[model samples]
Target: MVYVNNVGQAIMQVDRWTTLAPGQARNSVRIESYAVFNKGLFILDVEAAPWGCGVWPAWWTVGPNWPWGGEIDILEGVHDNVHNAMTFHTQPGCSLPTPNPKTSLGPNSTGWIESTDCNAFANSNSGCQTVDTSQASYGTQFNVLKGGVFAMMWADDGIRIWFFHRAAIPEDLQENAPQPNNWGTPVAFLHNTLCPTSKIFYDHQMIFDITFCGDWAGTSYISSGCPGTCSQRVMTPSNFANASWTINSLQVYRSPQISGASLALPRPRSLMYLSAGLILLLLYI
Candidate 1:
């Protein structure tokens, strides 16, 4: 079920995330209960507004240790008309080789630059690829003008992602409903491995949030002409102006047939009745 936290503003925000100052790292947000991620699948579905130049907004995941555990950046970028980068931050030992198909914009369009020189994974390195916005700019692409769905799925083997034009998101998964079969396996992996710590992999609470300007989207690209104050180039006053990213909701689901139990269960009361009858028979005998 989807739970909306109505505390801060009528606007949507998950209680699981702590809002930080503009310069805070994405890893800095503390989570109180991530235990729910044990063995099931987690999905994040967001509908966002477009922000202007230098304003970076993202929906990502990170683990305890820096690169040892891993990090998954599902959706991240600055300008509305630019790109939506999907990246993996892993330990030196683990090689995150981009498949032969490498980068793809839509199913037909493909091409992306891979960088191992700069540490995009570390606070020092920032790596990304731009998605063409000629068809529909980020602002118009997501808002009421013409929005779309950006999804990430997490599972055991690997990670995969797919972007759907507003018209494409299947009707069932549209409003944050947990529709596993329709999501497919590859997509599920990308969403799950965002921050793959063996213990916390599938058992942590996933979060969806928006910050004005933080380290990666805000500062890392400042030298490349991120517009803002010279001292803190990532922070742009115009960022909060016409900028906003909206999430209709987020939903999670476990495999339908994981432990041999039927996916279709009638009701809790029915199960209770069967247990009560078994208890009475045992006592009588």
Candidate 2:
């Protein structure tokens, strides 16, 4: 179910208080943006993200036509993960550099390249993933810090993702003028000579989902050391007490060279709740 909290944060959550029958999927929320973006800056200020076993949550963007239009996973995790994985899902011929240069990581970034291939068909749809090594980057620890900001830049050069702790968010970002270049090295950088951004990614819409015991989460359920099987856990409603998203705001800014929308105006209301969590307050700038 979805609603605004007493603090005015947009909340999308699972049916944690309801018990379900076998083979039944938990009721949740999945909302997408009405407006599509070609290349722009996306900022998500999160107060809390879903956690716990059998839970898979993501704040991402994807184009039409599946793999061809490409997918960028800015914030995604499954189960009891302590770190975040930034990924790109696309067709073959898209890849990041192996033995990535040290400069790829900003001085403050605590992440590393996990895979170079962007092929969704390869390695079981692993895609090209850069993983944040910091324990606070995801899950339980992230909630302890009360969440923070995730800024992504999708541009001609490539895509870059940066995470800042609540206490360390950049002043310019908080002031409404985000200068990504000055923000230093991103935790994950998807640029490479082999992958042309223009060919791989196109008009895409933002997506936020909180799924239970799906492919990504179920496949790794046992390995995560969570008690019982994924399906069994799904029947236990209380297991998802923490499986919800409390969002402060979501804002998008087009490049100065490409102008269309004004700065910080609410987009048209077109919320699609299929199966997971969504951001209720989204602004276009």
Candidate 3:
């Protein structure tokens, strides 16, 4: 839906009012951006999110192929859970290093990593992931607080994600100037130097989807012990009243001018220097 809210900003949502009966199946909503991006920054402000049994809503990015390409799940969860998780999916040869004792985290650095292997083909496709420690970061609690802003800074240095409460949105963002360096420690930080992003990851298209009774949500729906089959809970209407999303917009920012030289320049002491040295050595011999 499209309408102007009291705040006078345009809004779009996937607020389904009804539900399917037992054995009924409905294709969930999925919005994928056509543009492909590699290195950039993104900030998405959501007014509400889908949070209920058997509902798997996520805002993420994925490449064309499966494990060979890559995927970055910025937000994902199953059932009526409140905690939020971030995951990185790739092929083999990509793994994360455990944080050392010397590493210090700020107040916002409360994320707990579940797995260190980013390879989707490995670990049963669990991927390298981390969960947010903030209660007001997702699901029921997040809506109760009137939703919030999620910022992702993707660079060769590392991939970092930050959460800012609706009320805590920085003035800089409001003014359209986002300075991530000034922001506090991210809720999720995956160091990519070891994985070498270019090697395991590739161009991706943005995606926002809410699927029901599939892999993550369906297979694990019973883990919450909801007292029924995954499809049973999913088909019930009352179970999905809260399964929706009220989104403002997604903003992707990148450098206006390309950095570095467009063409490669020869080194000061390149192959020519080596050739000259080899000739001199042969003369001495």
Candidate 4:
């Protein structure tokens, strides 16, 4: 996938990859690649994201079963809101706490709930949760009009993530790793029984890209309240025209490391001599 701004261009491309059509929405796209499932890695870098009510910009991954398979939401939020959330969609056993203390779910609080129990907010949407930012700690203190980085890593054990502000991106991440901080804070979402086998659990590849507006952010009545959808509440035509979710670039590398050993045949004489020596030793014995 590729995005071009008036200044230049940003591209998201992968070998042996698949792209899905926009789903029931105007500004969204989906890309899939089972090849990277248990082999390599996938990285996404979003440029400037659109902020408005009914606007959903996401970078996430899912497994076979819906709630059972597990969902990892790297970056997801309504436009112009301060708190962008990192969530995991899983079975009953893997629910996360509201206002995650470890990651500082924050001061102003909208609590957490189980996937099966979030029905009150489900006005027809499948997986819906209400998070109030002014009440939450993170967004309450800052201005979210500007875009940032969001990222996730699906590995052998569990998912790991990091969210960085544009200025806070580590030098190492900027030079070597894809910069997720530019979009938002990175968080890992996990699911129970998503991977029945240990071999396949952490083996699947991850994808990174941006969706304009869809299920989560584009929900009906999203622009009503104080901590309502960011896109609906915050975006202006001027900013929407000038600002956009821009992806700089993406790169994938084997964690630990990829073996570099080469396979070559031994010289015939070397093999023959070794074999003859073994035969002579056997005879002597």
lDDT (tens digit, per residue) of candidate 2 on 1-285: 788777768888889988989988778888888778887778888889999999999999999989989999999999989899999999888987674475444233447777889999999999988888778889998988999999887777778788998999988878766666567778877774568888899989888889888889999999999999999999988899999888887767764452212222123122222211234544211
lDDT of 3 by residue, 1-285 (tens): 334466544333344555776687764567666567775677777778888777888989888897766888898888877888888998887766664345423223557766778888777899988788777677898999988889777776567788888999987766656667567678876666567776566788777777787888888877786668887776566677777767665567765221212211222111111121222222121
Candidate with top lDDT is 2
Q: Summarize candidate 4's per-residue lDDT along 1-285 as a digit string, tens digits.
A: 333444443433221132223332233334443433432233444445434443445556666645545555555565455565555554444333344545344222232322322122233424423232332212322224233344444544344455555565566456543332243322333322333222323333344444444455555434534344444333333323322344554444444331111111121112111121222222121
Indicate which candidate wins on TM-score.
Answer: 2
Error of 2 at 17 (Å): 1.0
lDDT to native, each model: 0.41, 0.80, 0.69, 0.39
Query: Of the pair 1 and 4, which is ahead by lDDT?
Result: 1
Off by over 4 Å in 4: 5-8, 11-28, 33-35, 39-43, 97-146, 177-215, 218-244, 256-285
* Model 3 regions lying over 4 Å from their true place: 1-21, 99-109, 256-285
TM-score per candidate = 0.57, 0.88, 0.81, 0.52
Candidate 4: minimum summed lDDT over ten consecutive residues — where? 260-269
